[model samples]
Target: MKPWSFLHISDLQPGSPRSYRFNQAMGENADTAYKQLGEVEDVDLLLVGGDLTRDGAIHDFECEEARDRLGSLPYPFYAIPGNMDTCNKHTSVAGATGRDDPRLNVTAEQLDHFALFFGEFPWSFVHKEVRFSGFYGAVAGSGLPHEERMWRWLEDELPPAGETKHHVMVMHYSLFIDSVYEPTWGLQDKEEYGRWYFSIDQPHRSRMFDAFKRSGVDIVLSGHIHCRKPPETVDGVRFYRCAGIAMPQAANLWPDGDTRLGFYRFDVTEEGISETFIPLEKESTAEGKYGPGGHPHPEDRDYSLAWEEPPEEFRT
Candidate 1:
Protein backbone atom coordinates (compact mmCIF):
# COMPACT_ATOMS: atom_id res chain seq x y z
CA MET A 1 0.00 0.00 0.00
CA LYS A 2 1.05 3.58 -0.58
CA PRO A 3 2.53 5.46 2.38
CA TRP A 4 0.43 8.17 3.96
CA SER A 5 1.01 10.84 6.58
CA PHE A 6 -1.31 11.87 9.43
CA LEU A 7 -1.18 14.45 12.23
CA HIS A 8 -1.75 13.31 15.84
CA ILE A 9 -2.70 15.92 18.46
CA SER A 10 -3.92 15.69 22.03
CA ASP A 11 -4.71 17.49 25.31
CA LEU A 12 -6.33 20.67 24.00
CA GLN A 13 -7.95 21.29 27.46
CA PRO A 14 -10.04 24.40 26.71
CA GLY A 15 -10.79 26.07 30.08
CA SER A 16 -14.12 27.80 30.78
CA PRO A 17 -14.88 31.53 31.02
CA ARG A 18 -14.02 31.44 34.70
CA SER A 19 -10.62 30.30 33.45
CA TYR A 20 -10.78 32.18 30.18
CA ARG A 21 -7.17 33.21 30.43
CA PHE A 22 -6.08 29.58 30.49
CA ASN A 23 -8.43 28.68 27.65
CA GLN A 24 -7.22 31.60 25.58
CA ALA A 25 -3.61 30.57 25.99
CA MET A 26 -4.38 26.97 25.14
CA GLY A 27 -6.59 27.92 22.19
CA GLU A 28 -3.96 30.21 20.76
CA ASN A 29 -1.32 27.54 21.02
CA ALA A 30 -3.63 24.96 19.43
CA ASP A 31 -4.58 27.27 16.57
CA THR A 32 -0.97 28.06 15.82
CA ALA A 33 -0.05 24.37 15.83
CA TYR A 34 -2.99 23.44 13.62
CA LYS A 35 -1.98 26.15 11.14
CA GLN A 36 1.54 24.79 11.11
CA LEU A 37 0.23 21.34 10.33
CA GLY A 38 -1.84 22.72 7.46
CA GLU A 39 1.28 24.31 6.02
CA VAL A 40 2.76 20.86 5.64
CA GLU A 41 2.30 19.73 2.04
CA ASP A 42 1.06 16.12 2.23
CA VAL A 43 -1.05 15.20 5.24
CA ASP A 44 -4.04 12.86 4.97
CA LEU A 45 -5.81 12.57 8.35
CA LEU A 46 -5.93 14.29 11.76
CA LEU A 47 -6.27 12.33 14.99
CA VAL A 48 -6.95 14.19 18.24
CA GLY A 49 -6.21 12.10 21.32
CA GLY A 50 -8.31 13.72 24.12
CA ASP A 51 -8.74 16.05 27.12
CA LEU A 52 -10.62 18.42 24.82
CA THR A 53 -11.98 20.38 27.78
CA ARG A 54 -10.86 21.45 31.24
CA ASP A 55 -14.12 20.14 32.71
CA GLY A 56 -16.90 18.25 30.93
CA ALA A 57 -19.54 20.79 31.94
CA ILE A 58 -22.04 21.73 29.23
CA HIS A 59 -21.55 25.34 30.24
CA ASP A 60 -17.86 24.97 29.34
CA PHE A 61 -18.22 25.51 25.63
CA GLU A 62 -14.48 25.56 25.08
CA CYS A 63 -14.34 21.92 24.01
CA GLU A 64 -16.99 22.35 21.31
CA GLU A 65 -15.36 25.54 20.11
CA ALA A 66 -12.01 23.83 19.99
CA ARG A 67 -13.46 20.97 17.96
CA ASP A 68 -14.91 23.40 15.44
CA ARG A 69 -11.54 25.11 15.18
CA LEU A 70 -9.77 21.84 14.55
CA GLY A 71 -12.44 20.72 12.07
CA SER A 72 -11.37 23.67 9.93
CA LEU A 73 -8.10 21.85 9.29
CA PRO A 74 -7.52 20.73 5.69
CA TYR A 75 -7.79 17.03 6.55
CA PRO A 76 -10.48 14.90 8.17
CA PHE A 77 -10.22 14.74 11.98
CA TYR A 78 -11.19 12.01 14.49
CA ALA A 79 -11.31 12.22 18.30
CA ILE A 80 -11.95 10.32 21.55
CA PRO A 81 -12.91 11.33 25.10
CA GLY A 82 -10.52 11.75 28.00
CA ASN A 83 -11.35 11.75 31.73
CA MET A 84 -11.99 15.48 31.66
CA ASP A 85 -14.38 14.83 28.79
CA THR A 86 -16.71 12.70 30.93
CA CYS A 87 -17.10 15.44 33.52
CA ASN A 88 -20.42 16.56 31.96
CA LYS A 89 -23.52 14.42 31.72
CA HIS A 90 -24.43 12.54 28.50
CA THR A 91 -28.10 12.17 27.57
CA SER A 92 -29.11 8.80 26.22
CA VAL A 93 -30.52 8.17 22.77
CA ALA A 94 -34.03 6.68 22.77
CA GLY A 95 -32.80 3.21 21.84
CA ALA A 96 -29.08 3.58 22.60
CA THR A 97 -29.23 3.48 26.37
CA GLY A 98 -27.41 0.55 27.96
CA ARG A 99 -28.77 -1.96 30.44
CA ASP A 100 -29.00 -0.67 34.02
CA ASP A 101 -28.90 2.80 32.50
CA PRO A 102 -25.10 2.73 32.41
CA ARG A 103 -25.25 6.31 31.31
CA LEU A 104 -27.84 7.17 33.96
CA ASN A 105 -25.74 10.07 35.17
CA VAL A 106 -25.58 11.56 31.65
CA THR A 107 -28.28 13.95 30.52
CA ALA A 108 -30.04 13.40 27.21
CA GLU A 109 -28.93 16.83 26.06
CA GLN A 110 -25.28 16.18 26.84
CA LEU A 111 -25.34 12.80 25.06
CA ASP A 112 -27.01 14.37 22.06
CA HIS A 113 -24.44 17.14 22.09
CA PHE A 114 -21.55 14.67 22.05
CA ALA A 115 -23.21 12.48 19.44
CA LEU A 116 -23.90 15.42 17.19
CA PHE A 117 -20.34 16.65 17.43
CA PHE A 118 -18.19 13.53 17.95
CA GLY A 119 -20.50 10.72 16.84
CA GLU A 120 -21.06 7.46 18.73
CA PHE A 121 -18.62 6.18 21.30
CA PRO A 122 -16.18 3.40 20.23
CA TRP A 123 -16.22 4.50 16.64
CA SER A 124 -14.17 2.76 13.94
CA PHE A 125 -13.05 3.52 10.41
CA VAL A 126 -10.63 2.18 7.85
CA HIS A 127 -8.25 4.09 5.60
CA LYS A 128 -5.71 2.86 3.10
CA GLU A 129 -4.63 -0.59 4.30
CA VAL A 130 -5.01 0.32 7.98
CA ARG A 131 -7.87 -0.21 10.41
CA PHE A 132 -8.27 2.58 12.98
CA SER A 133 -10.38 1.86 16.05
CA GLY A 134 -10.83 4.15 19.03
CA PHE A 135 -11.73 3.47 22.66
CA TYR A 136 -12.90 6.54 24.52
CA GLY A 137 -11.34 6.68 28.00
CA ALA A 138 -10.40 2.99 28.01
CA VAL A 139 -8.09 3.24 30.99
CA ALA A 140 -7.79 0.12 33.18
CA GLY A 141 -10.64 0.43 35.68
CA SER A 142 -12.88 3.22 34.52
CA GLY A 143 -15.86 0.91 35.36
CA LEU A 144 -17.96 2.82 32.86
CA PRO A 145 -20.14 0.61 30.67
CA HIS A 146 -19.07 2.43 27.54
CA GLU A 147 -15.45 1.82 28.43
CA GLU A 148 -16.16 -1.92 28.81
CA ARG A 149 -17.92 -2.02 25.45
CA MET A 150 -14.90 -0.38 23.88
CA TRP A 151 -12.63 -3.04 25.35
CA ARG A 152 -14.80 -5.79 23.92
CA TRP A 153 -14.73 -4.09 20.55
CA LEU A 154 -10.95 -3.89 20.73
CA GLU A 155 -10.65 -7.61 21.40
CA ASP A 156 -12.89 -8.28 18.41
CA GLU A 157 -11.01 -5.98 16.05
CA LEU A 158 -7.42 -6.77 17.05
CA PRO A 159 -6.74 -9.86 14.96
CA PRO A 160 -9.16 -9.08 12.17
CA ALA A 161 -9.83 -12.69 11.10
CA GLY A 162 -8.87 -11.65 7.58
CA GLU A 163 -6.03 -9.96 5.71
CA THR A 164 -5.14 -6.43 6.78
CA LYS A 165 -1.99 -4.38 6.68
CA HIS A 166 -2.07 -2.73 10.12
CA HIS A 167 -4.28 -2.17 13.16
CA VAL A 168 -4.10 1.11 15.08
CA MET A 169 -5.86 1.94 18.34
CA VAL A 170 -6.48 5.41 19.71
CA MET A 171 -7.56 6.40 23.22
CA HIS A 172 -7.08 9.15 25.80
CA TYR A 173 -5.19 7.18 28.44
CA SER A 174 -1.95 5.25 27.99
CA LEU A 175 -2.40 1.50 28.27
CA PHE A 176 1.21 0.45 28.59
CA ILE A 177 2.79 3.32 30.49
CA ASP A 178 2.40 3.89 34.21
CA SER A 179 0.67 7.28 34.06
CA VAL A 180 -0.97 6.93 37.47
CA TYR A 181 1.28 6.42 40.46
CA GLU A 182 0.14 5.76 44.05
CA PRO A 183 -0.61 9.46 44.44
CA THR A 184 -3.30 11.33 42.49
CA TRP A 185 -1.60 12.45 39.26
CA GLY A 186 -2.49 12.18 35.59
CA LEU A 187 -6.15 11.07 35.24
CA GLN A 188 -6.38 8.47 37.99
CA ASP A 189 -7.32 10.79 40.83
CA LYS A 190 -10.57 10.07 42.66
CA GLU A 191 -12.63 13.24 42.52
CA GLU A 192 -14.58 14.32 45.64
CA TYR A 193 -17.93 13.77 43.89
CA GLY A 194 -17.52 9.99 44.22
CA ARG A 195 -16.64 9.72 40.58
CA TRP A 196 -13.69 7.36 39.92
CA TYR A 197 -11.60 8.84 37.14
CA PHE A 198 -9.16 7.31 34.65
CA SER A 199 -6.77 5.10 36.61
CA ILE A 200 -6.84 1.41 35.56
CA ASP A 201 -6.39 -0.99 38.45
CA GLN A 202 -4.12 -4.06 38.24
CA PRO A 203 -6.59 -6.65 36.92
CA HIS A 204 -8.06 -4.35 34.30
CA ARG A 205 -4.61 -3.24 33.23
CA SER A 206 -3.50 -6.81 32.86
CA ARG A 207 -6.61 -7.77 30.88
CA MET A 208 -6.33 -4.79 28.58
CA PHE A 209 -2.64 -5.33 27.84
CA ASP A 210 -3.15 -9.02 27.43
CA ALA A 211 -5.89 -8.36 24.90
CA PHE A 212 -3.59 -6.04 22.97
CA LYS A 213 -0.90 -8.65 23.01
CA ARG A 214 -3.25 -11.37 21.79
CA SER A 215 -4.71 -9.18 19.05
CA GLY A 216 -1.35 -8.17 17.56
CA VAL A 217 -2.22 -4.51 17.12
CA ASP A 218 0.57 -2.60 15.43
CA ILE A 219 0.36 0.64 17.43
CA VAL A 220 -1.55 2.43 20.20
CA LEU A 221 -1.76 6.25 20.31
CA SER A 222 -2.61 8.04 23.56
CA GLY A 223 -2.30 11.58 25.11
CA HIS A 224 -2.98 11.96 28.84
CA ILE A 225 0.62 11.93 30.13
CA HIS A 226 1.47 15.19 28.29
CA CYS A 227 5.14 14.33 27.70
CA ARG A 228 7.24 15.34 24.67
CA LYS A 229 8.55 11.90 23.85
CA PRO A 230 8.44 9.68 20.79
CA PRO A 231 6.65 6.33 20.54
CA GLU A 232 8.01 3.44 22.52
CA THR A 233 7.44 -0.31 22.10
CA VAL A 234 5.98 -2.44 24.80
CA ASP A 235 5.10 -6.12 24.30
CA GLY A 236 5.70 -5.75 20.57
CA VAL A 237 3.25 -2.87 20.12
CA ARG A 238 4.37 0.70 19.53
CA PHE A 239 2.71 3.26 21.85
CA TYR A 240 2.94 6.90 20.77
CA ARG A 241 2.12 9.36 23.57
CA CYS A 242 1.47 12.73 21.91
CA ALA A 243 2.54 15.90 23.75
CA GLY A 244 0.12 18.49 25.06
CA ILE A 245 -0.77 21.35 22.71
CA ALA A 246 -0.81 23.89 25.55
CA MET A 247 0.92 24.15 28.93
CA PRO A 248 3.50 21.39 28.88
CA GLN A 249 3.42 19.58 32.18
CA ALA A 250 6.52 19.04 34.30
CA ALA A 251 7.93 15.58 33.69
CA ASN A 252 6.49 13.70 36.63
CA LEU A 253 8.24 10.44 35.74
CA TRP A 254 11.79 11.73 35.29
CA PRO A 255 13.65 13.84 37.82
CA ASP A 256 15.95 15.30 35.15
CA GLY A 257 12.72 16.98 33.99
CA ASP A 258 12.03 16.88 30.25
CA THR A 259 9.00 18.94 29.26
CA ARG A 260 8.03 20.85 26.11
CA LEU A 261 4.75 21.34 24.22
CA GLY A 262 4.40 19.70 20.78
CA PHE A 263 2.65 17.07 18.62
CA TYR A 264 3.57 14.12 16.34
CA ARG A 265 3.37 13.03 12.71
CA PHE A 266 3.00 9.40 11.73
CA ASP A 267 4.13 8.18 8.34
CA VAL A 268 2.66 4.76 7.75
CA THR A 269 3.47 2.26 5.04
CA GLU A 270 3.37 -1.46 4.43
CA GLU A 271 7.09 -1.54 5.20
CA GLY A 272 6.83 0.00 8.70
CA ILE A 273 5.63 3.10 10.52
CA SER A 274 7.82 6.12 11.22
CA GLU A 275 6.81 8.73 13.85
CA THR A 276 8.39 12.17 14.44
CA PHE A 277 7.94 14.64 17.28
CA ILE A 278 7.22 18.13 15.93
CA PRO A 279 8.07 20.64 18.64
CA LEU A 280 6.10 23.89 18.41
CA GLU A 281 8.64 26.43 17.25
CA LYS A 282 6.75 29.32 18.83
CA GLU A 283 6.85 27.65 22.25
CA SER A 284 10.12 25.73 21.78
CA THR A 285 12.23 27.91 24.03
CA ALA A 286 12.04 28.35 27.80
CA GLU A 287 11.79 32.12 27.56
CA GLY A 288 8.74 34.40 27.65
CA LYS A 289 5.47 32.55 28.21
CA TYR A 290 7.25 29.39 29.28
CA GLY A 291 9.88 31.25 31.23
CA PRO A 292 10.25 30.93 34.99
CA GLY A 293 7.06 31.74 36.94
CA GLY A 294 5.01 31.01 33.82
CA HIS A 295 1.38 29.97 34.04
CA PRO A 296 2.12 26.28 34.66
CA HIS A 297 4.41 27.32 37.48
CA PRO A 298 7.36 25.09 36.72
CA GLU A 299 9.63 24.53 39.67
CA ASP A 300 11.83 27.63 40.01
CA ARG A 301 15.16 25.80 40.10
CA ASP A 302 14.15 23.35 37.37
CA TYR A 303 14.66 25.10 34.05
CA SER A 304 14.16 21.58 32.73
CA LEU A 305 10.68 22.13 31.34
CA ALA A 306 12.17 24.42 28.70
CA TRP A 307 15.87 23.50 28.64
CA GLU A 308 16.27 20.00 29.94
CA GLU A 309 17.38 17.58 27.24
CA PRO A 310 15.29 14.47 26.62
CA PRO A 311 16.59 11.12 27.75
CA GLU A 312 18.39 8.76 25.34
CA GLU A 313 15.32 6.54 25.13
CA PHE A 314 13.27 9.46 23.79
CA ARG A 315 15.56 10.01 20.80
CA THR A 316 13.70 7.48 18.59
Candidate 2:
Protein backbone atom coordinates (compact mmCIF):
# COMPACT_ATOMS: atom_id res chain seq x y z
CA MET A 1 0.00 0.00 0.00
CA LYS A 2 1.10 3.58 -0.56
CA PRO A 3 2.23 5.65 2.40
CA TRP A 4 0.30 8.61 3.84
CA SER A 5 0.73 11.27 6.54
CA PHE A 6 -1.49 13.17 9.00
CA LEU A 7 -1.05 15.95 11.56
CA HIS A 8 -2.34 16.28 15.14
CA ILE A 9 -2.45 19.65 16.89
CA SER A 10 -4.30 20.98 19.93
CA ASP A 11 -4.77 23.70 22.55
CA LEU A 12 -4.31 26.62 20.16
CA GLN A 13 -6.65 28.74 22.38
CA PRO A 14 -5.73 31.98 20.56
CA GLY A 15 -8.07 34.15 22.57
CA SER A 16 -9.90 37.23 21.32
CA PRO A 17 -9.13 40.76 22.45
CA ARG A 18 -12.83 41.53 22.38
CA SER A 19 -13.50 38.94 25.07
CA TYR A 20 -13.24 39.59 28.80
CA ARG A 21 -9.71 38.10 28.54
CA PHE A 22 -6.88 38.33 26.04
CA ASN A 23 -3.37 36.92 25.72
CA GLN A 24 -1.22 38.39 22.96
CA ALA A 25 1.50 35.76 23.20
CA MET A 26 -0.96 32.91 22.95
CA GLY A 27 -2.56 34.61 19.97
CA GLU A 28 0.81 34.85 18.23
CA ASN A 29 1.73 31.29 19.12
CA ALA A 30 -1.48 29.94 17.63
CA ASP A 31 -0.98 32.07 14.53
CA THR A 32 2.53 30.67 14.18
CA ALA A 33 1.18 27.14 14.42
CA TYR A 34 -1.41 27.96 11.81
CA LYS A 35 1.23 29.25 9.39
CA GLN A 36 3.43 26.26 10.08
CA LEU A 37 0.60 23.83 9.36
CA GLY A 38 0.35 25.17 5.82
CA GLU A 39 4.00 24.38 5.20
CA VAL A 40 3.64 20.72 6.13
CA GLU A 41 3.57 18.63 2.95
CA ASP A 42 1.96 15.39 1.81
CA VAL A 43 -0.51 15.34 4.68
CA ASP A 44 -3.53 13.22 3.85
CA LEU A 45 -5.50 14.67 6.76
CA LEU A 46 -5.11 16.82 9.88
CA LEU A 47 -6.48 15.91 13.28
CA VAL A 48 -7.18 18.93 15.47
CA GLY A 49 -7.15 17.46 18.97
CA GLY A 50 -8.92 20.47 20.65
CA ASP A 51 -8.94 23.80 22.56
CA LEU A 52 -9.52 25.54 19.25
CA THR A 53 -10.52 28.80 20.94
CA ARG A 54 -9.87 30.54 24.24
CA ASP A 55 -13.39 31.56 25.25
CA GLY A 56 -15.34 29.89 22.47
CA ALA A 57 -18.13 28.74 24.75
CA ILE A 58 -18.88 32.28 25.91
CA HIS A 59 -17.91 34.18 22.76
CA ASP A 60 -19.63 32.97 19.63
CA PHE A 61 -17.44 35.18 17.45
CA GLU A 62 -14.32 33.32 18.57
CA CYS A 63 -15.80 30.02 17.46
CA GLU A 64 -16.76 31.50 14.10
CA GLU A 65 -13.28 32.90 13.62
CA ALA A 66 -11.68 29.57 14.50
CA ARG A 67 -13.81 27.82 11.91
CA ASP A 68 -12.53 30.20 9.24
CA ARG A 69 -8.89 29.94 10.32
CA LEU A 70 -8.91 26.14 10.49
CA GLY A 71 -10.92 25.89 7.28
CA SER A 72 -8.06 27.66 5.50
CA LEU A 73 -5.68 24.75 6.19
CA PRO A 74 -4.17 23.07 3.12
CA TYR A 75 -5.64 19.68 3.99
CA PRO A 76 -8.95 18.55 5.40
CA PHE A 77 -8.89 18.49 9.19
CA TYR A 78 -11.21 16.80 11.65
CA ALA A 79 -11.63 18.23 15.13
CA ILE A 80 -12.94 17.46 18.61
CA PRO A 81 -13.95 20.00 21.27
CA GLY A 82 -11.45 20.86 23.98
CA ASN A 83 -12.50 21.99 27.46
CA MET A 84 -11.85 25.60 26.52
CA ASP A 85 -14.15 25.25 23.53
CA THR A 86 -17.04 24.02 25.66
CA CYS A 87 -16.73 23.65 29.44
CA ASN A 88 -14.61 21.80 31.97
CA LYS A 89 -15.53 18.42 33.39
CA HIS A 90 -18.38 18.04 35.85
CA THR A 91 -17.75 18.48 39.59
CA SER A 92 -20.31 19.24 42.29
CA VAL A 93 -17.59 20.06 44.83
CA ALA A 94 -15.71 23.31 44.52
CA GLY A 95 -11.95 23.23 44.10
CA ALA A 96 -9.71 24.20 47.01
CA THR A 97 -9.33 27.70 45.58
CA GLY A 98 -10.26 29.97 42.64
CA ARG A 99 -13.40 29.25 40.63
CA ASP A 100 -16.16 26.88 41.68
CA ASP A 101 -15.99 23.51 39.94
CA PRO A 102 -19.72 23.19 39.43
CA ARG A 103 -19.69 26.40 37.40
CA LEU A 104 -17.11 24.88 35.09
CA ASN A 105 -19.10 21.71 34.54
CA VAL A 106 -19.86 21.28 30.85
CA THR A 107 -23.52 21.74 29.92
CA ALA A 108 -25.47 20.38 26.93
CA GLU A 109 -26.06 23.93 25.76
CA GLN A 110 -22.33 24.58 25.66
CA LEU A 111 -21.66 21.46 23.60
CA ASP A 112 -24.49 22.30 21.23
CA HIS A 113 -23.13 25.81 20.80
CA PHE A 114 -19.71 24.42 19.91
CA ALA A 115 -21.28 22.18 17.28
CA LEU A 116 -22.75 25.21 15.58
CA PHE A 117 -19.27 26.06 14.34
CA PHE A 118 -17.30 22.79 14.39
CA GLY A 119 -19.94 20.20 13.62
CA GLU A 120 -21.08 17.27 15.83
CA PHE A 121 -18.40 15.10 17.42
CA PRO A 122 -17.67 11.71 19.00
CA TRP A 123 -17.20 11.29 15.25
CA SER A 124 -15.57 8.31 13.54
CA PHE A 125 -14.63 7.75 9.96
CA VAL A 126 -12.23 5.76 7.80
CA HIS A 127 -9.76 7.25 5.39
CA LYS A 128 -6.97 5.41 3.60
CA GLU A 129 -7.49 2.30 5.75
CA VAL A 130 -7.16 4.31 8.95
CA ARG A 131 -10.02 4.79 11.39
CA PHE A 132 -9.83 8.32 12.76
CA SER A 133 -12.06 8.91 15.79
CA GLY A 134 -12.37 12.06 17.86
CA PHE A 135 -14.39 12.87 20.99
CA TYR A 136 -14.54 15.18 24.00
CA GLY A 137 -13.41 12.82 26.75
CA ALA A 138 -14.14 15.42 29.47
CA VAL A 139 -17.81 14.63 29.02
CA ALA A 140 -17.38 11.14 30.51
CA GLY A 141 -18.58 11.68 34.07
CA SER A 142 -20.52 14.91 33.51
CA GLY A 143 -23.95 13.22 34.00
CA LEU A 144 -25.26 15.37 31.17
CA PRO A 145 -27.48 13.97 28.44
CA HIS A 146 -24.54 14.38 26.04
CA GLU A 147 -22.56 12.05 28.33
CA GLU A 148 -25.24 9.42 27.78
CA ARG A 149 -24.91 9.85 24.03
CA MET A 150 -21.13 9.67 24.34
CA TRP A 151 -21.39 6.37 26.21
CA ARG A 152 -23.87 4.99 23.73
CA TRP A 153 -21.67 6.02 20.82
CA LEU A 154 -18.50 4.56 22.31
CA GLU A 155 -20.07 1.34 23.57
CA ASP A 156 -22.59 0.51 20.91
CA GLU A 157 -21.79 2.29 17.66
CA LEU A 158 -18.00 2.35 17.19
CA PRO A 159 -16.81 -1.15 18.09
CA PRO A 160 -19.06 -2.76 15.55
CA ALA A 161 -18.25 -0.23 12.83
CA GLY A 162 -16.12 -2.41 10.50
CA GLU A 163 -12.41 -3.11 10.67
CA THR A 164 -9.57 -0.89 9.62
CA LYS A 165 -5.79 -1.08 9.35
CA HIS A 166 -5.31 1.25 12.31
CA HIS A 167 -7.60 3.18 14.64
CA VAL A 168 -6.31 6.61 15.70
CA MET A 169 -8.27 8.15 18.56
CA VAL A 170 -8.19 11.85 19.39
CA MET A 171 -9.26 13.22 22.77
CA HIS A 172 -8.76 16.51 24.59
CA TYR A 173 -7.97 15.04 28.01
CA SER A 174 -5.57 12.22 28.69
CA LEU A 175 -7.33 9.09 29.90
CA PHE A 176 -4.99 8.83 32.90
CA ILE A 177 -2.08 10.78 34.37
CA ASP A 178 0.33 7.89 34.11
CA SER A 179 -0.82 4.30 34.46
CA VAL A 180 -4.27 3.04 33.55
CA TYR A 181 -4.83 1.99 37.14
CA GLU A 182 -3.64 5.20 38.83
CA PRO A 183 -6.12 6.61 41.33
CA THR A 184 -8.11 9.68 40.42
CA TRP A 185 -6.61 12.97 41.60
CA GLY A 186 -8.59 15.01 44.11
CA LEU A 187 -9.52 18.68 43.64
CA GLN A 188 -8.71 19.48 47.28
CA ASP A 189 -5.13 18.18 47.07
CA LYS A 190 -2.90 21.00 45.95
CA GLU A 191 -0.23 18.51 44.98
CA GLU A 192 -2.66 16.44 42.96
CA TYR A 193 -4.77 19.21 41.48
CA GLY A 194 -2.78 19.43 38.25
CA ARG A 195 -3.08 15.69 37.79
CA TRP A 196 -6.79 15.86 38.46
CA TYR A 197 -7.17 18.71 36.00
CA PHE A 198 -5.39 16.88 33.18
CA SER A 199 -6.89 13.40 33.34
CA ILE A 200 -10.19 11.60 33.13
CA ASP A 201 -11.45 10.27 36.43
CA GLN A 202 -11.83 6.65 37.47
CA PRO A 203 -14.45 4.16 36.30
CA HIS A 204 -14.71 6.42 33.28
CA ARG A 205 -11.05 6.05 32.41
CA SER A 206 -11.19 2.27 32.72
CA ARG A 207 -14.47 2.15 30.86
CA MET A 208 -13.09 4.25 28.03
CA PHE A 209 -9.95 2.14 27.91
CA ASP A 210 -12.10 -0.95 27.49
CA ALA A 211 -14.09 0.70 24.72
CA PHE A 212 -10.88 1.60 22.90
CA LYS A 213 -9.72 -2.00 23.03
CA ARG A 214 -13.03 -3.27 21.76
CA SER A 215 -13.05 -0.68 18.98
CA GLY A 216 -9.55 -1.67 17.79
CA VAL A 217 -7.90 1.59 18.74
CA ASP A 218 -4.13 1.32 18.59
CA ILE A 219 -3.07 4.91 19.09
CA VAL A 220 -4.60 7.47 21.49
CA LEU A 221 -3.67 11.15 21.05
CA SER A 222 -4.54 13.40 24.00
CA GLY A 223 -3.70 17.10 24.54
CA HIS A 224 -4.99 18.76 27.75
CA ILE A 225 -1.68 18.45 29.64
CA HIS A 226 0.18 20.62 27.06
CA CYS A 227 3.35 18.71 27.95
CA ARG A 228 4.70 16.22 25.45
CA LYS A 229 5.10 12.90 27.22
CA PRO A 230 7.02 10.17 25.47
CA PRO A 231 4.67 7.66 23.94
CA GLU A 232 3.59 4.96 26.38
CA THR A 233 2.18 1.54 25.66
CA VAL A 234 -0.47 -0.01 27.87
CA ASP A 235 -1.83 -3.38 26.95
CA GLY A 236 -1.83 -3.11 23.14
CA VAL A 237 -2.54 0.58 22.71
CA ARG A 238 -0.02 3.40 22.32
CA PHE A 239 -0.92 6.59 24.22
CA TYR A 240 0.51 9.90 23.04
CA ARG A 241 0.35 12.89 25.36
CA CYS A 242 0.71 15.53 22.63
CA ALA A 243 2.37 18.92 22.94
CA GLY A 244 0.38 22.17 22.94
CA ILE A 245 0.18 24.78 20.21
CA ALA A 246 -0.82 27.77 22.36
CA MET A 247 1.42 27.33 25.40
CA PRO A 248 3.36 24.80 27.47
CA GLN A 249 2.65 23.55 30.98
CA ALA A 250 3.56 20.87 33.55
CA ALA A 251 7.14 20.69 32.29
CA ASN A 252 8.65 19.77 35.64
CA LEU A 253 5.83 17.46 36.67
CA TRP A 254 7.18 14.65 34.50
CA PRO A 255 10.93 14.13 34.31
CA ASP A 256 10.79 13.21 30.62
CA GLY A 257 8.09 15.65 29.65
CA ASP A 258 9.00 17.90 26.71
CA THR A 259 7.47 21.31 27.36
CA ARG A 260 7.75 22.69 23.86
CA LEU A 261 5.12 24.33 21.69
CA GLY A 262 4.47 22.19 18.61
CA PHE A 263 2.39 19.49 16.97
CA TYR A 264 2.75 15.86 15.84
CA ARG A 265 3.20 14.52 12.32
CA PHE A 266 2.37 10.85 11.81
CA ASP A 267 3.34 8.83 8.76
CA VAL A 268 1.38 5.75 7.90
CA THR A 269 3.28 3.19 5.87
CA GLU A 270 2.68 -0.43 5.05
CA GLU A 271 4.66 -1.41 8.14
CA GLY A 272 2.72 0.81 10.60
CA ILE A 273 2.40 4.38 11.86
CA SER A 274 5.33 6.48 13.15
CA GLU A 275 5.15 9.89 14.88
CA THR A 276 7.46 12.92 14.58
CA PHE A 277 7.37 15.99 16.82
CA ILE A 278 7.51 19.21 14.86
CA PRO A 279 8.48 21.94 17.30
CA LEU A 280 7.39 25.47 16.45
CA GLU A 281 10.15 27.24 14.54
CA LYS A 282 9.63 30.12 16.94
CA GLU A 283 7.92 30.33 20.35
CA SER A 284 6.30 33.66 21.07
CA THR A 285 7.89 35.76 23.83
CA ALA A 286 5.64 38.81 23.46
CA GLU A 287 4.39 40.17 26.77
CA GLY A 288 2.27 43.05 28.16
CA LYS A 289 -1.02 41.17 28.26
CA TYR A 290 -4.17 41.61 30.35
CA GLY A 291 -6.32 38.85 31.79
CA PRO A 292 -6.93 36.83 34.93
CA GLY A 293 -5.31 33.45 34.71
CA GLY A 294 -6.86 30.12 35.61
CA HIS A 295 -10.59 29.48 35.72
CA PRO A 296 -11.79 32.87 36.97
CA HIS A 297 -15.33 33.34 38.20
CA PRO A 298 -17.84 35.23 36.02
CA GLU A 299 -18.09 37.95 38.65
CA ASP A 300 -14.33 38.38 38.70
CA ARG A 301 -14.00 39.26 35.02
CA ASP A 302 -12.81 42.83 34.40
CA TYR A 303 -13.64 44.10 30.93
CA SER A 304 -12.43 47.58 31.87
CA LEU A 305 -8.83 46.39 31.51
CA ALA A 306 -9.29 45.13 27.96
CA TRP A 307 -6.65 46.49 25.61
CA GLU A 308 -9.22 47.19 22.95
CA GLU A 309 -12.79 48.40 23.20
CA PRO A 310 -15.06 45.47 23.93
CA PRO A 311 -16.99 44.48 20.82
CA GLU A 312 -20.63 45.50 21.07
CA GLU A 313 -21.62 41.85 21.06
CA PHE A 314 -19.51 41.08 24.15
CA ARG A 315 -20.83 44.11 26.08
CA THR A 316 -23.25 43.17 28.83
lDDT per residue as tens, model 1, 1-316:
6788887888867454333123356656666676787677688888877777654434335556766777777888888776556532222221121122223333334433555566676777778877777765443343456555757776775565234567677877665444422332222222211112223444565666676667556788877767755556776778776688767763664453346777888898777878888877676322223332212211222223322342333222
User: Candidate 1 regions off by >4 Å?
Assistant: 16-24, 88-113, 138-143, 157-162, 178-199, 255-257, 284-316
Return the top candidate by TM-score.
Answer: 2
Local distance difference test, candidate 2: 0.89
Backbone clash pairs for candidate 2 read none
Model 2, position 22, has a per-residue lDDT of 85
Error of 2 at 279 (Å): 0.4
- Residue-level lDDT of model 2, residues 1-316, one tens digit each, is 9888999999999997777788888999998999999887689889999899998888888898899988988888898999999889888887766557888899899999988899998899899889999999888888888899999989999955249979999999999987999988998887888888899999899999999999999999999889999999998899999999888999877899999999999999999999999999899998858878777777867777777777776566
